[model samples]
Target: MIDRAIKLWFFSALVWLVIGPAIGAFQSLQFIAPDWMNFLSAIALPYSKLRIVHTNTVILGWIVMTFISAALFMVPRLCNTPLRFPQLAYAAGWIWNAALVLDLVLIWAAIPDSFWLSIQAGEYAEAPLLVDVMIVAAVVCVIASLHLTVFARERPHLYVSVWYLLGGLYTTAITYLVGNFLVLAFSGEGYQVIEAWWLHNAVGMIITPLGLGTAYYIVPLAAQQPLYSHRLSIVGFWTLMAFYPGTGLHHFLQMPVPIWINEFAVISSVLLGIPVLAVVTNFLATPRGNWSRAFDSYPLRFAALGTLYYLATCLQGPFQATAAVNWYVHFTEWVQAHAHLALAGAFTCYGMAAGYYMFPRITGRQLYSRGLASVTFWCMVIFFPIFYIGFTWSGVATGASINLMGNTIYQTINITWIPRLSRTITGTVVVVGFIAYVWLLLRSLRVGAPYESGMNEVPEMGIETPFEEARA
Candidate 1:
């Protein structure tokens, strides 16, 4: 049943959420405990390798799986159809699980850092070769979902959300091939540069679009309003497609790449504010004269805060792309703050909101609790700023001190223990927030009851659903 699939994906995603952060916390502590963490210390175990495992699990395993769950739930309903091959979709789910297991195996088997380098050359090894195969399988599952939903069915104009979904899948597959095979594996002296370029683009293209697209679809719907402007949505989509890929080079701000490429990336990253502002304008316009509606609705609160965070993240994103700022912030915890704000604060908010909005409709059951959802939203809002300010403060303060300490960079950076300890504290706070979120969601899913009578109602738009009409 739909309930089982929903539960399966949500639970699996939560498992990753728990494990990824725990590993990340351990990784963060290594800055202070380089030699002292006896239980964790190993000669062969490189930080780079552990970091990759942590990063990839959170990004690919957690985000992708959770997004897939949301997509599976939404595509069928929006298209007014059931999944074409539910069994195949279920099988695809198993493939994803198997892939994650294989990834862990490869990690445990001591996949060399050189194996990742092979990604750029478009070659594979015994271990990385397996990782590559797993990635391909995961992508195949994604492609199948796309084909079944958008390609297989007859419908009116394709929804904007579906367009973004398909676009994300297509570009992800292309980027995987180029990043892992062509650029990283094939290119040597310039391999790191290319890989970073691809990573930057992949995050922008794949994760942001899919997350934003899902929000675009669900937020207005939850608010019980039509999108403020379809025209603006089109503008947002096309401009994003044109600009986002080009912004990848901003990560290499001072590095030795073609000057033209750096300039191109700088301009594009900054210009990306245009599409971001456009979407913000569109979303803000949705609540014209109805701002109180957002206050009243749990889902609306999440959506509104997400839009605000989007603005903050994009503005900061382009600002950091500048060479002047990158000089001080590059590879610092400042960058980490930017990343968590974008991925965790913004994208994850949208994802969680979408999950709450769709779950009842998809399951043909009312939500378990609006009260718990409200608690989750506020926890998220409060959580983001605590980590944001702490990490940014630590990054700027420490970065400045390091620069001023001595004539040489290494000498300046010698006093790092306290700063690293601060980071551990900041990361711990973020983990606590995540724990709050998991608890709130669990209560909402299992214990809270469906809203009764007037409590269930959202404001009116033009929804024709029995649930909507009844709630209204």
Candidate 2:
């Protein structure tokens, strides 16, 4: 049976996946029709709080929790030992949920006026203390889980992937706590700087490390090959951990942060390309002659796309960080588009790969169908471009409107109705993708088979590797 901790973690992911996006959709619609649901809007509370909750849920509730569970399962297997204190692991899951619940309540209640303003500096003292406490609770829980795994068994040496997984969580815990509470202590303009830095920490230390760890585990396993360059992988991992934390300074380019911060952000961002290339080389080099084989597997396909998007997004990120380029795109839908593409498209794609890899093992069933998985992947391919291009086109139009038309943002937006209209229409395709995902997951859980059924060969890369020969 799948460990109870794993079950709870998956359950958290499923719940937040639905709730977070649903709220985001509501927020998106609020722009199209302001008063259509005035009562409901009021009930949801300030927009900033709602947005924060949604963002936090997606990041903490879904992504972090999912990894926490996956790592718990993987560690024992990698260490070649039975889980130590499995019951404690399950208890930690409950503690995590309770902490998150408190966080949600504090987030909603902290911001009194516009959700937007509360996130600002006016009510610094009144802001949520739960945010601070939640950080502590989260770190403690993580330490417990890791301790259980690390001490459970003795290996001659820890794998590189295991090192990354643990290092990512440990650093993320420290950074998350420091960025939110300690930095936000100063009230005035420092608040913006602190917040921007926090945003950087959230993406850099949290999401980026998690993604890296997942890729390290997934890529070599799928290719049935050891990593191409262990040295390069180690260099890339260390450089990224050092460099990514500063990337947040780019967000303050147009704002009134120190000018040097912007310059440093640009330089570090350019240096990021090195690590990006390193990882890309490692992943792509895996299936050299067997390219078709990896593509044939839907999980690998998603992972491939994720790596591709990661390169694209980082390239865009560095370019956009430049003062000349940002002057045109800052605060425009263009920035939003890139962010969504990177955060949702890139990360979600990788996460899907992990999920597909995990599903059958967790459920003790075979995938329902490969054809359905392929269909879902192709739909993603189509949906991604529509959103990407649509947002880029609209951003250009919006920039022109702001620069040349002498018209305000709201008025200029009306002139370029096609872009907004297309965006909403394209958004429907993403909804379809989510629906397909739900169907695929449910069917796999209920009707799938074991790896030894002549369908999938369970690779020896460790317990986390997905079986090949079935659906993704």
Taking all chains together, the TM-score of candidate 2 against the true structure is 0.87
TM-scores of all candidate predictions against the true structure: 0.85, 0.87
TM-score of model number 1? 0.85
| Residue 322 C-alpha lDDT in model 2 | 85
For model 2, residues 1-472, the per-residue Cα lDDT tens digits are 2367777876677667666655665566545555664556578665666676767677777677766666665666656676666666677677777766766776765556553323434221223455446545755665666666677666544555666677778877777666656765677677777777777667677777677667666666666665666667777888887787778778778887778888888888788887788778777776676677676566678878888888788888888888888888877888878877776677777777777766666667767888878766876688767867777888888888897676797797686667766666666666567557757777676676665433323223323323221223
**lDDT of candidate 1 at residue 307, scale 0 to 100:** 86
Ten contiguous residues minimizing lDDT sum, candidate 2:
462-471
Model 1 off-target regions past 4 Å?
1-7, 33-35, 43-49, 111-127, 152-154, 362-375, 404-422, 443-445, 450-472
Query: Candidate 2, which segments miss by more than 4 Å at Cα?
Result: 35-49, 105-127, 151-153, 451-472
Per-residue lDDT of model 1, residues 196-243, tens digit only? 667687678778777777777766766667667766776788888889
